[model samples]
Target: MTRVCFELRIKPELLDEYVARHSPVWPEMLAEIAAAGRRNYSLFVAEGGRLIGYYETDDDTAAQAYLTASPIAARWEAEMSRFFVGLEARPDEAATPLTEIFHLADQLAAASTTSAEGDAL
Candidate 1:
């Protein structure tokens, strides 16, 4: 699975309402996300309304396409657009993924391979 992480900033004054809105995302929206092949999705908000989001998908492009074509997702994004800052496009479309620097599982798997090679040597 591809792990996707993205960052966006919310208007600090609207942070509370933003959080409240997500307390229970629309059921149709949630269903659409799962149908888009995104799993383990989560969002985090830091001080000053910095928002970080993460999710795993088997095919990021396909997932994005599915969500983009979904009417439910469109409605959700339209409502959420007001809480963001400096985004010219819909929030979902504007969520440029952050580059991944490290992952513990990958490093551990590499270490195991090296150790096994040494044992065979």
Candidate 2:
């Protein structure tokens, strides 16, 4: 599985609306994502309206092709551009990918288990 992560900025004032819309994401959009070989997708919001999106995919190229060919994705991007800045003016209307230095999920889980055991003693 390949892990992907990226950051994008959204207008603070539009956060509420954005969250509401995402509460029940379009079915077709979800289907498109799945068809693209993406899994365990998640998004996190940070200070200053920065949005961090992460996902694991078996085939990144296939996922990209699926997304680019999806009509639902295109429409969603157009609607979402209103709440984004750089994307609105960019040719692709998509966020740039970020480099990942470290991912320590297993190590963190082991540390948490160790801490719990110590607390019980």
**lDDT by residue for model 1 (74-116), tens:** 9999999999999999999997689999999999999999999
Worst 10 residues of 1 by lDDT: 88-97
Per-residue accuracy of model 2 over 45-110 as CA lDDT, tens digit each: 876778888899988888887777778888877777787756744312377688987779967998
Candidate 1 runs further than 4 Å off:
none
Question: Which residue pairs collide in model 1, if any?
Answer: none
**Candidate no. 1 TM-score:** 0.98
Model 2 whole-model lDDT (C-alpha atoms):
0.80
TM-score of 2: 0.78
Off by over 4 Å in 2: 88-93, 105-121
Per-residue error for 105 in candidate 2, Å, reads 5.7
